[model samples]
Target: MIELTLIGIGTGNPDHITMQAARAMNAANLILIPRKGEAKSDLVDLRRDICAQVLAATVRIVEFDMPVRDAGGDYAQGVQAWHDAIAAVWREEIARHLPAGGKLALLVWGDPSLYDSTLRIAERLPGVKVSVVAGITSIQALTAAHAIPLNPLAGSVVITTGRRLRAHGWPPGADTVVVMLDGGCAFEALDPAGVSIWWGAYLGMEHQALESGPLARMAPLIAGRRARLRARHGWIMDVYLMRKEPSNG
Candidate 1:
């Protein structure tokens, strides 16, 4: 049986890796790193850097090209098909490297339990014993970067994606909303009059940028800055939180 450990490396910061994740990385017989093309080659490079920093053992490290998702079909079908293709790649890599059951690890960007789907892909691997090592999330990094609490006064915070926010507007009963995987900056579609937003791009990195204030005042600034940052880096990862004051309700 292949012992598959999904280790959360936390926002590409080597310091964010938990001791448990470090131990798992050291113990793995083989580690798979996915290369996400030239535009995001830095992502794979960061994983390599993290391994060089934390790994003490001479474990086998292999890099594979990440498959691009087919955008022609319905969204859900396309995503499912994409996931299947990724799983096939994983299987092929394991067969080529291991050939026999052994310990393997994949360094995840953040806690697998969050919005990530690594666990779902792992489920497709037969006779594999799956384990997870948690690490800091981007939301935590975003909040800590801005020195703000996730929720105010014990208010409920709804964590959703940019698509959901743009399609449905603010969720009901949510006092604060954290948006992730938002390449489009969906906040522009909101009313933004009474909402306060704290936005962070490339959180926990040296080139990190942050902006906050009333959404009405900060929306354009955030949009402009986000565009410029993406243009400069060729890729960007960002998250934002919007809070509606009680007075505005």
Candidate 2:
């Protein structure tokens, strides 16, 4: 049986890795890191840096090209196909590295339970014993970086992706919304008059940038900043939170 450990390493910060994640990395016989191409080289670099800091010299590190989902295809279908392709790649790499089953680890960005698909891909490996080591999530970093609570006192928050927020509109009864995986500034689609936004890019990193204000005033600034950062870095990962005016309470 293959012992598959999915360790969340947080956004791009090495220190965000938990002790559990470090232990898992040190214990793994093989650790697979996916190359997201030159546009997102920082992601792979972060993975490599984590391995360098946490893994023992005896542990083998492998890099594999990640499959990109086709934007022209149905969104769900494209994602499913991409996941299958990734699973095949994982199986091939695992077989090549460890003909006999052994402990393996994959470093995940942010918590697997959030928006990441590492856990889903692991399920495709039948009989694989899956273990998860949670780390600081982007949501946590975004909220903490902004020095704001996730929700109003005695209230609740809804966590979602940029696509859902843009396509389905704000969820009914949601007073606070945390948006992630947004390649575009989906906040532009919302009615900004009464909304407040807290946005952060490269959270927890040295180059981190944060901006928050009334959505009407901050939307354009966040949009411009995001574009500029993406141009400078070749790619970017960001998240934001929106809340109704506190006076509405």
Candidate 3:
């Protein structure tokens, strides 16, 4: 039987790694890192840095080329094909490195339970036992960076992606929403009135950037800042939390 561990290391912060995650990393017979090309090379570097900081020098680390999804095709079909390619790569790598079947681990950027699809991909593997080691998510990092709670007193919060927010608008019955994977700053389309926005880029990293104010006021500022940061670093990961005034009955 093969044991597969998906360890979440959090948003590019070495210190974000929990003791349990560290143990999982060391316990694994092998670790795999995905190389995401030149633009996002820093992401692979961060994983390497985390391993170097915690893993014993004797631990094995391997790098593999990540599959790129074809963006020109239908979105849903493109994603399905991409996931299939990734699973094929994983199967090949595991067979080459752990032919006898032993424990293997992959360090994930954020907690697997969130919007991430690593857990889904792992399901493609046959007869493999999977375990997850939770780590900080960008939502937690953003809220902590801004010193705010995710939800109002006894209130609920909605979590959605930029695409969904653009297509569906504000979620029903949601007073607070945390938006992730927003490439085009979808908040600009929103009615900013009565909405306060707190935004952060590169959360928990050395070059983190944050902006907050009335959505109307900070929308453009954030868009511009986000562009500049992306130009400088060649990549950016950001998330924002917006809360509208609660209705008074």
lDDT of 3 at 17: 98
Q: Is candidate 2 or candidate 3 better by TM-score?
A: 3
What does candidate 1's lDDT look like per residue over 1-249, in tens digits?
Answer: 889999988997889989999999999999999999999988988999999999999999999999898879698888888899999999999999999889999999979999998999998988999999998999999999899999989799999999999999999999999999897999999998779999998888778899999999999999999999999999999999999979732
Summarize candidate 3's per-residue lDDT along 1-249 as a digit string, tens digits.
789999999999999999999999989899999998899999998998999999973667899999998989698888888999999999999999999999999999889999898999999998999999999999999999999999999888999999999988999999899999898899998989899999999999999999999998999999999999999999999999999997777
RMSD to native, candidate 2: 1.2
Weakest 10 consecutive residues of candidate 3 by summed lDDT = 52-61
What Cα-based lDDT does every candidate model obtain? 0.93, 0.90, 0.93
What lDDT score goes with residue 134 in model 1?
94
Instruction: Summarize candidate 2's per-residue lDDT along 1-111 as a digit string, tens digits.
Output: 899999999988888988888888999999999998899998888888888887765899999999888888598998889999999999999899988999999888889
Stretches of model 1 off by over 4 angstroms after superposition: none
Give lDDT: candidate 2, residue 173: 85
* The best candidate in terms of lDDT: 3
Give the least accurate 10-residue stretch of model 2, judged by summed lDDT.
240-249
lDDT of 1: 0.93
